[model samples]
Target: MLRRRGRLPAAPWLVAVTLSALLLAAARPAVGAAAWCIARSGASEKALQSALDYACGPAGGADCAPIQASGLCYLPNTLAAHASYAFNSIFQRSRAAPGACDFAGTATVTLTDPSQLWIMHLPFISKHCRAIRNTRLSILHSELHV
Candidate 1:
């Protein structure tokens, strides 16, 4: 009887595949961020003040949304939207807004649809929304309101 040649086992391939898979999984980009639904709404002028008042339960509130650029990360989407709207209630007014401020101060954004909205900086976003509003308003003021 002719002796059969001994074939090498394929264990290495299995290990390689498993390791590759793990590495691939680890390398996945911030994909979940796409799942977020973004929407915003502007609050009344000084909405922060109003919210504080409401939260305070009839104390006249704190007089502001209680947030800054760095603080945007702490605010929820809904809260941020309101604050943004309030800060920059006027679209045309925002168009002429200055740069590098806490919130944009003229636009309102809506963050909705997905409850688990993955925001990088909640406060920053809110601020930007306001800024956008301010910019738009400024433009309007220059173009029409003026």
Candidate 2:
């Protein structure tokens, strides 16, 4: 080991490296803390519909094509289902920015996998699961692998 009589030259570099590491860690999501946004359970249908409209509207700019009449996610045909999808879409598009999932308090964030929970709630999952469109599933699969 080499010792310097005066101040060490590496002090600045060490500080910079420490700061860079802290910044990168702060920018990243917490380990094993996968998060998703969903419509709040027990919210009135009217409220859910309103939030859904906002989520699908220009203000929210969420991809709502999946919830249309002929869309893959239309089967459930419930306000909660539609709202959940819309809320999550906008939440994700916003990169989960603060208040992105609020929807006037009709929406919330969850650590649970909302997509899986939604699928489980579908009545026809056992019989018609294959018939449902897999666009979202495929996208999720791609993302997980990446």
Candidate 3:
């Protein structure tokens, strides 16, 4: 292969990829402004249950009715799902206070929208999906106005 004096074949695509990655990174919210809280993966179900209880209880005071039987988010019916919902609820309620997302290390804060994750995984035509869509829209509206 003969090298051109002033041109590199790979340089153009490399530059384009670098710029695309940078733009995507810049479009996301800052690390310090994580907007959702969820149960950390690898966290024990027991710990999640405890955190869920605390969040829905008086101390954490998260609105947890949505995870109740027949409630909008009741499907999935797993510890992690319910805990994530409760964690995010309290986190949002407290305006993302310094320690609000800790949950004794069982929870983590992230910029990703947890509701959107749920919506994507569930069947699009399911009743649960519609409920979550409505809920997510309302949450987004509140966030925008705030």
Question: Which residue ranges in model 1 land beyond 4 Å of their true spot?
Answer: 1-58, 61-76, 79-120, 123-127
- RMSD each, Å: 14.2, 10.3, 9.6
Locate the minimum summed-lDDT window of 10 residues in model 1.
31-40
- Candidate 3 lDDT, tens digit per residue, 53-135? 99899988988887788677676777877888888888877888778888989998777655567543322224565678698
Encode model 1's per-residue lDDT on 40-67: one tens digit a residue: 3443446444543343243323223334
lDDT of 2 by residue, 1-146 (tens): 78777656798769988999999997766765666778787788888888888878997788888678877667677777678778877777777787787888898887666545755343122134334556567888999999
Better of 1 and 3 by TM-score: 3
Residue 141, candidate 1: how far off, in angstroms? 1.4
In angstroms, the error of model 3 at 140 is: 22
TM-score of 2: 0.61
- Candidate maximizing lDDT: 3
Q: How does candidate 1 fare on TM-score?
A: 0.22
The regions of model 2 sitting more than 4 angstroms off are 1-32, 118-131, 135-146
